[model samples]
Target chain A: MDENPGLSEQYRTASPWPFFIALSIPLAEAGILFNLFAVAVGGLLLFFGCCAGMLQEAGYVDRPWRSLVVGAVIVLAFGGLLLYADTQVANEAVQLAERGYAVLVAGIILFVGGLLGEVFVDDGEFAV
Target chain B: MQLNGQLALTILMGLFLVGVFAWLTRVENWSGYTPLSSGGSAVSGESGYVSEEKPAGIVRWLTTVDHKDIGLMYGAYGVFAFVVGGLMVILMRTELATPETVLVQPGFYNSLLTSHGITMLFLFGTPIIAAFSNYFIPLIIGADDMAFPRINAIAFWLLPPAALLIWAGFFPIPNLIPAQTAWTMYTPLSAGVGQGNQMNAGVDLMMLGLHLSGVSATMGAINFIATIFTERGEEVTWANLDIFSWTILTQSGLILFAFPLLGSALLMLIADRNLGTTFFAVGEGGGAMLWQHLFWFFGHPEVYILVLPPMGLVSYILPRFAGRRLFGFKFVVYSTLAIGVLSFGVWAHHMFSTGMDPRLRASFMAVSMAIAIPSAVKTFNWITTMWNGNIRLTAPMLYCIGFVSNFIIGGVTGVFLASIPVDLVLHDTYYVVGHFHYIVMGAITFAGMAGIYYWFPLVTGRMYQRSLAKWHFWLWMVGTNITFLAMILLGYGGMPRRYATYLPQFASLHQIATLGAYMLLLGGIIWVWNMVQSYFEGPVVEDGDPWDLEASGLRTVEWDWFDRKLQTKIADGGEEEPVTDGGVVEDESADELDTDE
Candidate 1:
């Protein structure tokens, strides 16, 4: 723990993606737009997680207002667009259902990308 | 336990393992107990490095974050799994002793076969490699430890529960489902719910275990990838990072791609059984072949994943014994990278009999044959490295020789299997069995043993009994040839594999193979006993470089670490502390020893 203490903490703190992704799986099995619901939740969580990490890396003593606002709005808009399809046009449900898988996969990639934010080496180079 | 009970059992199992791990490393002291330190030769009255605080009894091991300690644990555990897996094979050989089900029921035999393959490949192969890699990579790459040490710990900690879960049905519970899916766990058969009252809760558990192993391997791979790429002490680079790390780098990349896919497949299989979706349910949108396609995609590269490290170890070890730098060093590295890319393209070769497209089959056949070229290059380079050289016939060197010899047969037979014409006839025969085992048992295990012997002194700081190691190596060689060669012959005689009973024509071959199995088992036991007993009480290596590294031109980083420790112990003028051997005498500084010399 003594060797670069902060690195150990970040490594130890569990990632949110696994927990959310696991939750989304059973929900997806419930059928229909429930799968899309899972995808939306996972993406929103990951977006926020990445924001938190990026904010920390950028040396923010307070909340990263500009970035956090930009991140939250972008995430909420994307998720809201999908959720709105659940109640609106009948074709919207069909379209979102088909694209749910694509969203889920994108979420996974985003989470992997988020990992890069906090895991850079001491020389400020990316670890991977 | 039933599938329904697993959700809770999983939680409890996790807690138990974590608790045990914590309990193991939390002891008070490790002073008298030198936790498996391998160093250079010790000179009389010279200072030796002694750890002051000793963590008490077993806890030091359980809680250890030290790479060397972890490596020793991995090596010991791998050997234990190897012995257990081997015993299962011996029982199966006995069952086939007389071309009849003489020893066990068909189902039990199936269970044994399945358990043996899983244990050998996942439990034995990777962990043993992990043993060597963990111990050496940090020292070799000039890093203090793995990039993510805690993740390394987590990766290893996943194994015990994984092992328990795989063989869960056979112990503590009676008549619960036994996972008989073999190593492949191909669909339709592995669906688990199709057979009434024949549901293998073990399949789900096995898949869960497989998933855990994938996570473990992936974590290790990520750590290796990071360590090699970033932690190289300014002097090391892609060109000069050493052959073993380069191979590990390539192997880690493969694992990253291969293992995650395996994990996804295993998870889908779990969903197919528990969830309503039929990802592999035949007659539904999903079918059996999907499983095979996905599996072999990961499976073929997996053969490389298991063997690549040993291949690297061979490249690293062979040169020192022969008193030369490895021949075609750059070519070997290029060939290794070539094979890593080419392995992904050869997966379809395993499916030649699956009625795949004729064009596809032919292409796969070509690529399968193509993958052999790099291996051939490796072989020629090894032999040339050994040719006209001052070869020291040490135990490690002898195993390297055996590795090359067995891998030739292994590789050639693979080419034979790669031909669509021959593969059609020999798809599930004992020839395939013999060929893969030659690579696995003969090449990889042989090289693994070579690495173990060559580095044993470096790790334990004590020399094994040379006479016993000689007996063990010869016995292993003789046993391996006698057993696997008999298998090839049986295949040529049209004997199929995974059969509990065979025609009377196979009686002699089975008996011969059985005898060979007995020999292998005896030899393996001797090796294990030699390691255990010798580690604690064997003669300490007085001069660290037993292989005479100064003359050999073998400049490995571990030798550097050995030099540093020796120098530090001398400069400190540390008094001799009771090491693992329980023998101590008054010690003088390295300066005094140098003056005497």
Candidate 2:
């Protein structure tokens, strides 16, 4: 039987990434608006995770774990830069350190998760 | 660092979603939806290899990326938003009836007014147009589906969260209250500086929701541009591309430019509110007028974004009922493009009363008035198309006629406002309100209805009750003119808008408008009931050309696709297909009967 009933091979049937990607933005926004660190870290993690998943699903990346590792490095660098700015700058209202903390924590969790996936999960083993 | 109940709830919810995402990713069967039945494009035998299994119930809707299914979802979502917006205005109109804040407090009234405008424009207007375009664009252009079907689904899925965020203030949440800022979200006031509840987190949520909507619209626009450019069948060339596709293409261009600016403006405003930025702060070097400059730049084009598609709807649907090809179809297409280009230049005319430079205002005024030329061209073509032809006054035709009638009034009123002198007088008054409502409600919504009724059979595979549809049309016609015209009269009497209270002198006209609102409410009820009852219980359409478009050589591609679907279903013994013999091609070969180019 044909996998996709009516559509061509070029079109995706459905993907779980969009739903997660869409859900992640608002959660992140709500976290920032309300100053909730746990929610903020969780949202950023979900957002980056879904992006990597989407990239791998589209075959843009052979190993999404490598992409995630690269993503974690960038995020960690961004967080480190913000923390460095907080030390040099003196704007009371901006709260650079707090934002940096959230980003750093999310980056650390993503790094650990990606490292594990790199060791254990094989490519194309989880293709939906 | 305080762990509160709300924070805990957010964490738990986030974890649950992550778990669901993980589970869904692990499950294997990600091949498209199984067609549950033999009807509806499943047996059309496109690209070979038919599947006999279809997913049933909620799962089919939640995960399917089919353009047709997604279009139906968009339609349902838009209608639901319409009901929400309508109820908000009904409360507002009832309060305006007595002019003494009889029904609700002033703050809540402000909330309702703001929500109504935003909800109607962003929620109902754009999504409803998407509903039509998504379903029909592929069929008409002879594409398999949208260019990026997953992205199309993603675009739609974004809107639900956007709506929830926009309406979050109305939900029962601590420290959250509906933002009283009007749909414009002008600065200084929208900067959360006032003693009013503008400082609430709800305002931030509203802006974010609005930003999400812009993202969704931009994505959809990109898809339309790609699909129309890359996915059109060989026969459906640019020269003969339907007027509706032309308008969608042009509107997508406008969206591609306009919505990103809106998203940026919204983000800057959000940063200003939360992070102490002075981008829109009055005292800290960023002038409040700068916000208006950025907003109306996108905002003015946003008006055309809401309007041009409906104009396409009327242009495309009108001639079919008039029993003629559209008069000046190329001119209509050109006018659509012309409107898209000129829409950007007229943004500053909205700021004439703000004491901008007179020289600058004059340029804006000239461009504003010049933009009216293309609009007038469209109106003229519609009337000329219907002039001497056999005009069938079906429900859709009545709405199209009403669209032209109301558009003339709206356009003329808007022309006067485009002049610096008149706009200065009517800057924030009831006149501005009446003028836009004429275009938005009287013209745009009327065109939307015409499209809906015209394509009812194609969407639902059933016929709507004709008598009830006519009733819906008349009530809305009489109701719209009454409500909006009284507003014009009140504006003439120097009544201001965005007020919960007014002098007793304006009471009678306000009451008249309220009476008109009641009529519209009744009409809306009839429409919903008729559509619902007709979909499940009404007569199922057997003949493919339900409107008998072939009789005038006016049959288009969608109906041909529908004819094929009906033939396939009949061949599979679902229902016997009836012969459609009454058309201009009656004597011709059956194969050529569906050709209408």
Candidate 3:
């Protein structure tokens, strides 16, 4: 038997995405804790961007923006439901409306960004 | 806007450090042991898993997925957390010396109390054990790396952020005070009912941090389980698998079952705090007892999850030092599995004083009492393994012996608390505090030290200062008993726990405990100094078998790997001839090696 292997025989020796993803979560948490709209929005942007990068690097998808489009649609639907609950339900929790609005805005941003990336980055003359 | 600026400054500082690091990597003069993508690539054999041209310096630690590197990072992180937790307790102990909140305000004292408990258990205890398992498991099991390397890295990466979120209350953020709900975070008060800072978003941040930690632990548990199941070598079967691996496998199982429940409960509590849910609201559908039930359901198993690996460590290391195979090896393995399975059934024992149904309480009491049998069985085997054997009085062995002694005290006290009558009296008292500190600090941390000292040569390629190690061990042993025993006596005097100021009757014992904590702090400082100094300047271990394991016929696979690496280094003209400094150069027969039970 081999006493030791020459090196870890694995693909993707290193990636910086996990570090950014880790950083983003606490930033998002800080935003929610302190009621910072801009900080929260920025954190979500970095969070999703890093996640999309990771999936594409792992070859989970050929185009990160395409998968993000699906993610955007799903989050938008969930956000809309939360908004409806805040408006229609009598026993809604505190800040349920604010949380819904935040999620809705995130969904809108992701949807627009994904479409733009697909048009400009993926379908461009110098597409990766 | 100030808060925003602070955040920006923090990000800027982080980027500055990264930039300096990137620049330093290009500077050849800034070198000592620049780790390759794989941690040990420099010493790895031609046939060993060595990276062709791995990134050096900070980038290696930041992004590398190698188990050994990850393990080292876990060790460093756990040590840092331990230091933080230790300092918090030292401050609390100082405050408790006179029991009038002399050192800080009662609110901040409460924050320190909450942070200490969570930090020790979640941050130090679990991750320190993870440090050993992550580093050693793949080596012992003959795996190239952990089953999912990237996922393993992600699991560890989650911790720093989790720590930030958990301790955010202590940071200079506006209106974000630390949580005083205690680590248990019992409901009603935890649902922002208290006049204290519990109503602030700090408690919510703490819960989120706790949730992130739980998620991280769950992911790590899955990785360990998958690796152990799929990665063992051909010769490493269930019958012959090492004891440390067995304990870790069992600990991983406990984590898989326990931490997710904690995550869900934490989420529910956070919702109650931030989203105004009635999940834990006192007058609403959810009641206070629900939180107790859920928390302890995860919490009690969490105790075992923190402990079993230490038990494994002592069992593995004690045998080598005792010059014999561990007696009843099969029974130790059986007891490990038994403890893991029975740990779940006894979570309600923590809820005995919660006024649950008498019948349910009795059943929980029985299971709790029964679970002690497996622990005692393992202890019995450890002692029996050392019985009539040539015992070495090394630092690691002393700590292993200390582990058993402390486990006995801690386990017996825990057993008394399992009884309904006894628990009703001792619940929320200094006695309960004494009982767990005995296990967590006395037993578990001792075992961790034993493992660290035992593997010092293997990890650092140098021997630690023997005299300093002994002093460190002796101080901690004396300090642990003095501090904890005083707490136990105070418990008998009807002293309550978690109070910044106590009745004047408890002053003498409190002072004595504080004295003991000072000793522990001294010992801890010595240990850190020894580790740092020894790693860089201590005598190099020229031989593979540093402890002369072959003399006792107790050499294991990891040592075999070490020996092969040393030989390869010599063959490639890498170093001088092996120096005879208590290490044996000759190898034992394969049959003799297999004689290790």
**Best lDDT goes to which candidate?**
2
Residues B1-597, model 2: lDDT tens digits:
355775776669667767866666453222323322421222222121112222334545665667887898899999999999999999999999886877999999999998998899998999999999999899888888888766787788889999998999999999899999999998888989877779898889889989888889999999999999998988989999999898899999999999999999998998788876779887774678999999999999999999999999999899998999999998999999999999999999889988889999999999999999999999999999998998889899999999999999999999999999989888888888889999999999999999889888877767899999999999999999899999888888899989999999999999999999999999999999999998866677778898888999989988887777666554545222232111112222232234421
Candidate 3 residue runs with Cα over 4 Å from true position: A1-13, A30-35, A88-93, A112-128, B1-52, B571-597
Q: Compared with the true structure, what per-residue lDDT tens digits does model 1 show for residues A5-66?
A: 11222211111122222222222222222233333444344335434432322223122234
| Cα shift from native, residue B418, model 1 (Å) | 0.2
Tens digit per residue, CA lDDT, model 3, B121-174: 999999999999999998898877787776788889989888887899999999
Q: After superposition, how far is residue A24 of candidate 2 from its true place, in Å?
A: 1.4
TM-score of each: 0.77, 0.91, 0.87
| Model 2 chain B lowest lDDT segment of ten | B580-589
Candidate 3 chain B weakest ten by summed lDDT: B41-50
lDDT of each: 0.71, 0.82, 0.81
State, as a TM-score between 0 and 1, how close model 1 is to the true structure.
0.77
lDDT of 3 by residue, A22-112 (tens): 7667676566545555555556665676677556544455466876777678767867886786776466335556656666677788789
What TM-score does the first chain of candidate 1 have? 0.34
lDDT of 1 by residue, B185-280 (tens): 877888875654334566676777777777778988898898788767767777787989988989999999999999998888876665445789
* Model 3, residue A103: C-alpha shift (Å): 2.5
Score candidate 1 by lDDT: 0.71
